[model samples]
Target chain A: MTSSAAATIALTDVAARRGNTTIWDQGSFDIPQPSITAVIGPNGSGKSTLLHLLLGLLEPYSGTVEVFGSEPREASEQLGFVPQSYHVPGSDYLTVLEYVRLGKIGNQFFWRSPKGMDQQVADAIEAVGLAGYERRRLRHLSGGEQQRAAIAQSLMNQPKTLLMDEPFASLDVRHQQRLAELIHGLRMDHSIGSLVVVHDLNPILPYLDGVIYLLDGHAHYAPTSEAVDEDLLTHLYGCPVQVTRTAQGDIFTRVTGHAP
Target chain B: MIELPTVTVQENWLEILTADFMRQAFIGGIITAVAAGAIGYFVILRQQAFASHALAHIGFPGATAAILLGIPITLGMVTFTVVGAIAMALTGNRLNDRDIATGTILAFATGLGLLFSNIASTAAANVQNVLFGNLLATTTSQLISFAVFLFLICLTIAICYRPLLFTSISPEVARARGLHTGRLNLIFLVTLALTITMAVQVVGVLLVFALIVTPPATALLLTARSLPALFLSIGIGTFAVIGGLVLSALFNLPPTFFIVSITTLLWVIATITRPQNA
Candidate 1:
């Protein structure tokens, strides 16, 4: 089922609680399509929760969630996800080529290697610059390469909206740069929108088109080029944190004044 | 099965085949071989080799209780082990996290088995076959039951193949795709329970672990893919079963021990020398 319709993720009056503590309450947000949106928040400030709700992973206590204007499962053909966890243990024997092939399974474009799977696999690997490593086992790949393979797997079907959680969690500068480039290319070349849930927002600033500032069960929006000053940073982080733009051409996080 | 392996190795070999006891042994080995290999694939994938062994051992007490009750032991063993497997799957991601829970379940089941066994006055050697396995007693009826187990396993795996594989490998990914993960896990557990129950008579408890783990472990060295490894593991298991059964028959050795030994030896050698990628 090819859906040409606009793909938007919206949550309304969503609240979640574990035991008695309310993690999020009456939070509402609408993410735009054809754009790269960054979801940034402190550890317990409902970052992953927001992503989960959007992806329909966790049903909200009281709200409606729609992806591509349909239920998450209903529109799964238009969505793809790269989760935060590492590759599953005991499944380390899968080759990079076969591992990535899983991304294509649910869709109509799935390839069991007969018709046109090779090109798709090659393109995905080259897009991530993991060209020579398809034959390597998933366990043997470096953390960054494995991340790329994960991305390759997620993109095997060329999803309309790709959801990634901490995609650059533990990568070196080179890998982070490569991933940033690929994310940029996905937006430009494939026109595939992306929502990235991240703790450290500075590394992803370059490729982002918008920001979903979440704080204590609430979310606000800002364009990527806007000045995310100390006030905005502190409010989003739920702590006093200074945002500095350095001449080395990068942003830095620093401790600011004590809260009043 | 194969003309009784008319061999010159042992004077007892030809004579034993004539005994109803030898016929049961051969049929029993064949039954457990197919049953173990089929359920073992998921056991290997769920990384539940240890957990499955623990599940099989759980039957000891139930079997003992049945022995004391004078009821058929197979039904008693299946009922308890299936419950054990289901309980483990239902609890929090028992497949992941710490081994403390598996350790607890193992101790509890073994304790129950001991309790029942201690109460039994007859304490027939047949209980040992149920606990460890006794291919020497595999009768025609048991062989039919095993064939049914094999058919059930094939049907279950066939119907739910993709979802099962998806959950087994990348559960988070499968969940993101909105697959029914919890139900699929239950299906896998049910399949595993069938293996333990069917093989309990032929290979016993200790060797059941070896049956479920060894072929897959060795196949892991040769294939980095899931389907291929599954077929390859079953293939390796069939060979192991045949070799062990024949060797035991020819030389008058315990079939379970012989099969497990050969399988373990090969797995260890493969682990040492096979390409490290897998």
Candidate 2:
């Protein structure tokens, strides 16, 4: 692993509020280059807001955020985002290939179709395991396939950093594994930095290099091993949380009073 | 059975079309139809049909006020729709729920139109033209304006095609990729306002909504590709305009009535026979 000084994204004493409610205060974190970091938080804990701040969609009321040594807005092309619900509404005519092609639209020339864009789009689709489904309409795809297509679309920009919000929320276990594999492959092959917001950390814990926990409008950056500890999680969630290790040496979380 | 309107016996379709006004109306209507058809595709794609409708009604008072002030109705309609578009865009940006802003703008516009039409009794003579259209009374200058505006719209679409499509599909993703979605939306609303002005001169305020929605809706039902649907919409709109002009001339009825009827009929047919990916 590279040193902390080689961080691709750095936030210094950032604070953000939306409509009279403070989402985050004095939040600070560093996302290293070419690493997968899970942003774990309960609902309304500003996990998505962190992504928004990094994407320049929302500004921090105080402090600074830098991506690739520049402002978030200036480094947008180097950053790709896969939103929680990438199924764009009211577009029945949009095909998978066309949807993926939209990613390249931001950086390419607008007046004419760029040379080699078709090959690039095809490569992206293939990278996400959606090769045969290029011409299919987006609405026809399964939830998992749609998510893959969204990932392929994000990959069209060839971003160095990818930010995803609740990507595994709607997928089944099988699809979640498939998406994790794809994300792991991206991190390994391209050294693409990733920050994924997850409600349940067990699904992606195997591929995550580090974790950032948000609680009570504060950020807690921890190593992967320390992040999954029972005492740390119990303190983070304000509940008695259990971390169980299975026979295969895999870890999972269970709330003390909740049924499996 | 419905009572049939008495038809004026004309020498021939060719003979009726030879009049300078008929020729002008035909050409001008075609121009408006082409522009509306192209613009309508994005309107439906982005789900801005209701906003477009509100913009048309908002232009009503502008046309009436122009008549009372002895100015061109086109200028008045353009000015009012632009103002309404800006107001609605700003409100939509702030509220996040565009329906509330659009509804509020529509109601306020309708109220202003009612007040203006009632204030100047002399302008009431032209109110019917504003509400129902005056295609037969279209002047050469209006046709020129239509052509110029159509060129500008086509140019704008051509230049901003990719970015516009990206923003329309998923604004958040596009914004993350550095496309200014708010500015794009504002530009789209203003362009919609211009389109409303053009179609208003041909189909009037009430029926212009049909021209701006029905053809694209029908095309969307028929095709599965955006470009193909766009071309299909243009074809349908142009055909309806020409057919409506001919039938209105044959029946000696108001052209706006026939145009709206024909466009609605096209939509019904397209819906019933829509392809199920066959």
Pairs clashing within candidate 2: none
- lDDT by candidate, in order shown: 0.74, 0.83
Considering just chain B, what TM-score does every model have?
Answer: 0.88, 0.93
Docking class of 1: acceptable
Q: Please estimate how well model 2 matches the true structure, expressed as its whole-model Cα lDDT.
A: 0.83
Candidate 1: regions farther than 4 A off? A1-5, A18-20, A106-119, A238-240, A244-260, B1-9, B15-24, B94-99
TM-score list, all predictions = 0.90, 0.92
Across A186-253, the per-residue lDDT of candidate 2 in tens digits comes to 98987787899998887888887888888777877887988998887887777779999889978788
lDDT of 2 by residue, B200-268 (tens): 878888888778999998887887677888888989889988888888787777788888898999898
TM-score for chain B in model 1 = 0.88
Q: Model 2 clash tally? A: 0
| Total clashing pairs for each candidate | 9, 0
